[model samples]
Target: MGESLSQRLQHPRRSLGDRHRSQAEKFLRLSNQGEGEFSVNIQWAEQNARQALLHDFTHPENWRMLAKIKVLLADDIGIRALLSDLFAVLGRDPEYVSQLEDVSLLDVGSELLNAALQNDHLDSDIWIQSFDASDVDSFVERFLKLDLSDPRCNVLFGRRLERLWDIAGSDVCIHLGKVLLSHRPQNYEMWTNLGRAHERMGDYDQAWLCYDQAQSYAGHLTVRDDFKERMESHFDGNSSVAWSRPEISVRKDFLVTMEKLSTRFSDSVIDTGASNEEVHVDQSGDERRLENMLKNGDFSSAFFLSRRLVTSGEMWAKEYLEASKLALEGKDDVIIP
Candidate 1:
């Protein structure tokens, strides 16, 4: 019985190898541009590669385990997996807004973009520079997912396209422009997009580097004044150059008064988890001593105080901004929960 079982239990290791090669050839044939089966090739490649997985691919939770196995066999194969997936994706819009949480798309895209840049393949796409296409304008206006917001996607996309800050899409150019004004805020080209991104973000100070830097580059008096005037109008226009969050000043004032009122009515405003008594904050700064007066609840004082804080914030926007930033950095108690 043992001898019979051994003959019946023969493993097809060599047969599997032959099958793998055949599948690989089929994958190449199916990847033709005209045939439009690249996505199919990708899927087949992934399946074939997974057949070589150390763990049972049939198990539901073994994808991560399979990846670990792939990485062991070859780091480049893992990278190819990333690029293949990116090329197959990143370009096409997915109906589902969800992303692969197991593989952070941002990190994956950044790695792929760096590889592309190292290979000197940055300027392959030119749609990044054309500001004239009315037909291909951003019809994808409404953001279905918060993560897929233009600002966030632009950053991830730009990083992936090498210096694509400038191409495959206008939104990319606009986003990279904004990234320029953050820490590396000196890259003139980035600042240009930063200006556009700021416009989209609703910040007027988000002027393009060309407008801002034109002053230095001006060789003639008339040209310098023309550029400067244009820059001024650009900032003064609908550019949404928010220094921070919306209603930021009011938010600050609301927070400050909240702490003061919280101390005044310590029993009510504290969120001890056990207590259910509620509180509110008003940033409008239009309330008075009567408004601050609380009764069976601290909510009134909290609301009025918050209102005063926010309203008062507008009067001292810049000052409040500095103080708010310092508080953020120093962990000041003036900060409201």
Candidate 2:
């Protein structure tokens, strides 16, 4: 209880309303600041902004801020103009801000005070609008699936994706990408996308960090090497298997020597930044290997496999149950080489 979970969930208990409105405007500012200009989808701009901002953070207080903003701009030709003004201030301003304190939250208020900056701001010329309400709604429905944890994964989309790295400077997309990496450390796709973005930025070391962090497994040293080898082999070629060249193989005994390796991570190579759940759910075991074992009726092999899992005390894996049952049945396929 280093921080009270309740305090971690700090919401104002007092009402300082515009008679009692409190300074809730501050929360909106920080949320948008964290996101670096909430880019709206012109036609479905209102819907997109509402959901994106709402889903971006899981905190209840953040959602309350979104609800309040929706109430504030519920009317209008559309919230597009007002939203644009908010984003204009949101642009170039977050960069200078330090420590994410509370006053800059007021910058958003400066615009809320102005009614006519609405005309000064323009809709993205490139965003097409549609007359059908459902079309906009449907587009937003798909966007709802977009994982906000990784900005680069989604921002580097369409042709805009290709030109993202070519922009005037680190635009909203890049800024959000960094925030995502720093904040959502447990998200692999977040790390993967950041690595991809770093590749675009030509910071190979940083990019490699992203890749290495994503690629690491957390178990035995020998098995980790085998996993790494398998991962490297995946990059062998666009024309073949790997993308790199070897006049010949490096660990001359790579084949025979590396056979004594564990396929799953233990603890040491485990990257805290990656999700532990992802390691087991989607590691690099070839489907062909599992399928062949089943096809060859390698029941003892499957039994021993399941035995390790059961003894590992992971309780939830049904694979462990099946293995125990197979061992009870005395299958003969397993004879470790």
Top-lDDT structure, candidate number: 1
Off by over 4 Å in 1: 1-139, 142-152, 156-315, 319-337
> How many times do residue backbones clash in model 1?
22
lDDT of 1 by residue, 82-155 (tens): 44432322332332213443555333534443443343222224333432345233422211111221121322
Backbone Cα, N, C clashes tallied per candidate: 22, 21
lDDT scores in order: 0.35, 0.33
What overall lDDT, based on C-alpha atoms, would model 1 receive against the true structure?
Answer: 0.35
How well does model 2 score by local distance difference test? 0.33
lDDT of 2 at 229: 58
Candidate 1 versus truth, CA RMSD in Å, comes to 21.0
- By summed lDDT, the worst window of 10 consecutive residues in model 1 runs over 328-337
